[model samples]
Target chain A: MTALQLDTKPNWFMANWQQLAGFGLPVLAIAIYIGDDIVEGGARLFLQRLFDGLDNGAIYAVVAVALVLIFKATTLINFAQGELAMFGSFLAYVGAVTLGLDDVKVGPIPLGLLLSIVVAMVISAAIGAGIERVLIRPFDPSDHLPVVLITLGLFLILNSLAAFVWNVNPREFPSLFPARNESGAQNFVEIAGARLFYDVIGTYIVLAAIGLALYFILQRTKIGLAFRAVSSNTESARLVGVRVGRVLGFGWALASAFGTLGGALVAPKLFLKPDMMALLLIFSFAAATVGGLDSLIGAIVGGLSIGLIQSVLVGYLGDNDSAFIILSLAVAFVVILGVLWTKPAGLFGTSAVERV
Target chain B: MKAGSDLAASPEALWSEVEAAADAGWPQWVRTLNRTVLVAAGLLLLILPFLVESIALRRNASLLVLSLGVLGLVVATGKAGLISLGHGAFVGLGAFAMGAFVDLVGLPYPLALTASFVTCCLFGWLLGLIALRVKGIYLALITMGLAVVFPSVAKRFPSITGGTSGRPIENTLDAPAWTGLTDSQTIAVRYYFCLVVCIAVFALTRNLLRGRIGRAMQAVRDGETAAAAFGVSIVRLKAGAFGYSAGLAGTAGALQVVLFPFVSHEQFNVFLSFRLYAAAVLGGIGAIIGAIYGVIAIVIVPTLNDIAGGLIRNDGRGLLDNDVIVFGVGLILLTFVSPDGFAGLVQRVGRRFSNRP
Candidate 1:
């Protein structure tokens, strides 16, 4: 019996082949790229690419989750989600740069940064909820085209509004996690000969904290339960005494806040323009689809993989140029089409059943 | 005695005559009225250039081109219930394809126009075939993704596409000397060229929509399973819808260069697609008149600004400042007030007046 067990293949591998394939493929691609350079000159470049992937992935994940939030609540993809978040980032610009909050400080924190963050979040939450109440609630929710069109209309309105306000010129959004003035404090920590900046580390930590807060609020709170109940089944939740309409409003508000924060995080890197989140929105849409539209964790996985895949493709297959960006998008478009054709439910989403 | 007399009147033949009158014959009065109105409209259109300023006539020609473009969207998004937010690219493809046919392949205007329409239609069919698996929200995203790649691809092929700076087309369409029109009235001749194309294309579209293919599209739009049950090829219908729409858009684009004399990358960007989608919505997706009205909505805005320019600003860009607001808000209001669009409103008013009898 012991001999039979030892000779036999592991059951775990047999049971989790799909998951293993999922993780294995990426690892194999990386290994193939960095073959025989585990400790050589390739290590630093690899590490740097990996870090960049994570940074890009983190931003994509947030935006993807923002999309997932609205999808969860209404089963409608918000085309305007990016624009709404861009609006929030604009609010941040207004609070910090326009309002002179960046110049002042409250103790250790810069007053402008703090004020922008808090105000932008609060106002964004309100705007998101108000939009659901006023604009979305009025439309027939079951028809997908009308809702999508509505969001698209909002996209135009919000985008042009931002441009009208800011004059279409690019503005530098001051980084929230500004590097310390001292050169010694700003020193990069070398990891496997790759230099990691403090901003990247700080950003990762901040994202984690935000994610943690979201997870708890969604998984552990009373309002979270109401939100989930409505998302799962609005009419059924209403039968159970939950205010379905209010939950939807709250759901939208939360989604907008999340998207706003995501846009804010990316604002500095994107240089704050009306079209700042436009390309990122496409990537996030792809990420959301690949991860499974209904799954939160799927969004994160999708983002990270997209980021990694894109960085790797650019590094190996193409150079950093407009043409290369087009190539990357084309590849992403293919991936989306493939996933849609084969597995419409995505990797983690529950398969939707349509009744005739 | 009366019954016997009626029986003598070829009873079977009488019933057949009744059926023919009921279904086939449009009432003579209504037909005559329609012809009269059409004649009047045509006469007015023919003489419109003579009455209006050169700029206004040129704009009218541009409007006609836009109408052709939006007509394609009406078939796809309007008739088939397929939400396409990327038709702007089709317009570009049509324009560029026409340019290529004329300049590179050395074809004349008529052949180039047909080639452009066919090329764009074929593309639409190909993309429609790929999108068979997806439905609803995902379908929209798939189409949007397709739109996103258009500009980049256009930019990549700078040689044929003329890159960022758009290429100028040869002035092949000109007034015949037999018309007694001078060089000063050449713009009127341009208007006539557009009229001929528009009439031919619209007639073709009407014929197609009333036939078996149109019936298939309507069936698919309403209920897919039922249509499939009837042995209708769903893929064919879907592909046909997209292809037809794109074909019309390309035809319009070909004419667009005729009117403007230049085709550029900026003219076919993603935002233009949004504007087209918005135009379809405002025009009433399924109505022919909606396309005309919808194109007019966008075309007339700047004209309105020019009219209101003195009141608002000295620089002549005041109305543009509120363009986004107007378009965005206009779309929302359309959804609320008349989801069927301006054509729907016209139909309602017409009904209300007709009902007074």
Candidate 2:
């Protein structure tokens, strides 16, 4: 019976692989057809798309991680996360322009980028802490929906305020990396008959560094332990001498800071506009769900997976505009279906047992 | 449940007090004069087409479609307790069906409308099944996901949906010879048709609220478990309510297509769904009368903003920029101060004055 069961499991796995292969073959064929000109060009295109996906995924990861932190500590989704990030970007713009740091002669690129990031993070953290103290503190956490509504209300208020302050025009944001070629001229270094994009390399390095730093903090810090404790059981954490309120506030602040960094990083790629993050926010929500809303690692994995899927689908398939919308719905449908099919908890979610 | 008892008692006492204080208030003759004035206003509206130019009539005809959309919301969110952020999808479904039938399939406009209504009803039924399993934020999120996903799906079948741009519908309405109306008079005729539809819908909605189904919905909204224990099929009721709401929205979309000359994907974006919620809330969520008031406010706000901007000789851009801020602030203030909305507040104030004795 044991041998039979084992055999069945392997058969099931093989069947799943076969089904995936059936779907993937068409995509592979399309890619090969498009990339037939240059072998290295095909590889370069793949690498570029992958790196771009990682960068985009990293933004989602930061937002999702922020959401998870707040959810863990306070059991709230913080619907205003996107708006907070938007506000942060606006502030970054102000810091660059108002502070006269936009001058090209202001030292080198690294110093200016560091200064702007610091300013953005500080402003973002303050906004996060303020919202937590003023808007969220009065609401009872157990009554979840009303709190969600309040966050939505705040979202509207912040979005409108951002629009009111920064007129609705999409502004050009300065890139963190210097775009000038290393040889003091427009240079394209051909490697294996394909050019290596510098932006892709920079993005990969930054995302990797951020991911490593986050992993270390969660795994090896005292604050991280308290955060986990509060998330697991707030009442127990309080009993065990953890300042639950402070932890939640800290989580919000951290989320805001991460969101600000994401906005800053992505601003150069996309135009910095008040409503720019609206669709991104929806995409992030899909990623968060796919990763399991409460799981940090799941969020990172989910974000990367979604980004990859979105890029590849758009690159090889027809009409890239609908890719995000289609992918988001597909992910949501799968997540919901998976919940019904195997475990209602989710792919990586802890099964929530209600006592009452 | 507590609210029901309050409603039953307060109105009776307020009416009697008004009766007693009538002498001290406005004279009986003056009161009769006021009623006459109100009646005259109604008569004036009925005969407006005879007096006003066709251009104003044409413009105001669009308001009827908006009113119908708000009325649909009154059923879905107000009565049925289903907060659908994607009601526009149903509206789009209805509009697209109407367009396809009347223009492409060579069906009569009225029959096309019926087809639209049926299509929306079916879609609503499907959505309601999902709604039955979720409540509160999850329901809201799911409906939002539907809205976010709908435009892409609509664009997928370019031949049917006309792709991103959209297809135009030829004029289906012709002025009959007996009416003594020209092409210019068609606008007034359509306006009356819309007004009649609105009145009929309002009457039906009011009657529905007073009936057993509305009571069951209210009971479900108040407490699902208790309603279930009382032998109410919560799932069926929810589905019925959603279907009914979708039918109303579809009817509105059909009217919109008829009034306008074209139908497109841009007409049914996610913002439209948000605006529907705003109109419902601004009007008064739970009341039929509130829906009418809400639709008027929603229409008038933007128009008034534009007018004000024009008056000052400022470009309309600033006014447009401030629109979101005003809407956001107004929504927050309305929810905070009068959770029952403007209609409820007006009703309460009217009662307070009537209870002077």
Candidate 3:
């Protein structure tokens, strides 16, 4: 068994502006054009593409972070994470319709939003706990595939159950953030002669807040320490007097809560439905992989990067049939190769020893 | 030991005991009951064609293709412990291969079927190689990605694939003059062909599970490391299982194209993969009979929903329209209440009666 190794030394270039500029310049040029049109709307298109990518990336980050939390404690990827989020969104929709919360007369925004969110979170957490107790507890941890199969089974069950209960109608969820007026939306702030969309500004703020809150919780809390301990070695932690089951329960609950928030944030943009998060989950998986599944910070960074790349690709490469697929494949290939080569543990993931 | 001793003394002694019992009881009634069941089965088989309305038969004919698809899943998830989320891609491959062979290469139907099976086997082989590298969740993800990417990949070659709209195959199985049957009768013959093929596949799968290879697969599923120590080539077994699964899925696809006369990427999407998984679990994941039951449930449940919707005049709007919910709820209930699946539950009850006190 090889001992776990931690990187202590940080490169000055990682912090230096000059090095960042050198790396950014080439990316900027590639973002401009390739074998396609270079003259018309190229530069403006590139910036818009970048913003779109960031927005999508922020969504992925939310899902990836939820996945990371569960993975950290359980070392099992909860396949039902996406379904839980979908369920939450469906609940939000249900709240809007049945309770008359979506009505403007109730308030500027529906009263159901708050009630729905709380209910969704509790329900999601209950689901998380129920799965852990019922499906997961019976299986041996070393037997990874059976647990995975159980989760897959859960995934199927949750998706279908949600559909059955709510129906497959796509409901428009009320946005948490108020929509901007037409005049406000049309105008863009000029920055260094480049137009900056205000929506992008709101997205960044939300993403930044999530990132900061996550960092503070993970880095500065006793619960976070316990989480890390459990993640690193469950048996050892148990030997050291940690209630492993409760920790797992908490992990799942935390992940579900995160998923609830994620669903609430993104569901309004896309109409809410049972399978709303199916495609987004794939993107989140890609992000999680790229960010290094074990690293919370890595998930955020990877998600943002993926979002940016996807948006830019869509903008510059055009919405040709093969483009998005090829881009995603390429990204996945790069991440897999990168992990296998320079860092098998991931960019932000801690290097660990494998004992056989 | 007592049972074995009784068995050893059985031929003459058993006959005498049977005679005694027959004298005491109504042996003719037991025989009559068995005969009645047999007669009922025969009559049902004979009357099914006559009873099924033409329109219902048409719908059922198309449903058989999906049933066959679910059967393929039985081999992969049931016997092999491999979860393939890209089975639709294999189905598509087989369908398109059949089309290409029949339309472009000008091959006969039988030869085209063989070509489709062989091509799908090769693709399955490649997928199996990937499965060998990564087990469980990663394997599922890879297979899903393959399914997701298949449509775009198919679209890239529009001339051969017919692009997004998909290609239509000419019906090669027409009513022969010698048969002297009506159009519906000829279609019924095709449906019977599909039913026979499905039954044959199921019987073959049953036999396979009862054989040494089946035991080896079970062992591997239970414990790979232990199986390896027992001299089972883990890689070969898994890959072979995957190949077999792909072949079955491909055959099902070929059958689908024959029945429908049209093939498209839209028919074989990631959602289809999820449905297959749901069906497998609904029927009973590890049992051969479970797959058949699952396929029937998958086909019949939504169909019932549609009927119910029509009767109520609701049009099955909203969630009723989405079969995914039905599949999902069925899966959850099956897992939570009866892990062995609906078929397994039936089998258990049957066993109870068979072993009556």
Tell me the number of clashing residue pairs for each predicted model. 2, 1, 4
Model 2's CAPRI class?
acceptable
lDDT digits (tens) for residues B83-177 of candidate 1: 88778889889988888887788787788888999999999888788776688788788877767767777876776678878778764566777
Model 3 chain A worst lDDT run, 10 consecutive residues: A1-10
Model 1 steric clash pairs: A101-A112, B283-B290
* Candidate 3 structure quality by residue, lDDT tens digits, A287-356: 7766777888888988898787676654556566366755665554444433333344456877656542
**Native-referenced DockQ of model 1:** 0.41
Q: TM-score of every model? A: 0.86, 0.79, 0.78
lDDT digits (tens) for residues B1-357 of candidate 2: 444333445434533433343235344443454456446745765887888688766666676577788889889888888877678877787778888888788887667777888888888887687555665555666666666566667776666578889877774666688988788878776777767776677778778876778777777776676566567798899999988898888888888777776778877876677667667777778777668668667757777667664433233345344444445556656765665577667655555567443
True contacts kept of 3: 0.21
**Model 2: residues >4 Å from true position, as ranges?**
A1-49, A97-100, A104-108, A142-149, A178-196, A208-230, A234-247, A319-345, A354-356, B1-56, B303-316, B319-322, B344-357
Winner by lDDT: 1
DockQ, 0 to 1 scale, candidate 2: 0.24
* Candidate 1 ranges with C-alpha deviation above 4 Å: A1-41, A106-111, A179-187, B1-44, B170-189, B308-322, B352-357
Q: Candidates sorted by TM-score, descending order?
A: 1, 2, 3
lDDT of 2 by residue, A1-356 (tens): 68888799879877667435543664586467756533544777666666556667777766666676676677677767878888898788787766756663445555555577778998898889777876677667876544554666666678767776676789988767655245665433455554545655566576677678777766789877787888888899999999877877777887888788778777877789887776666666656666666787777776776677666545554345566556555554444433323333334667567541
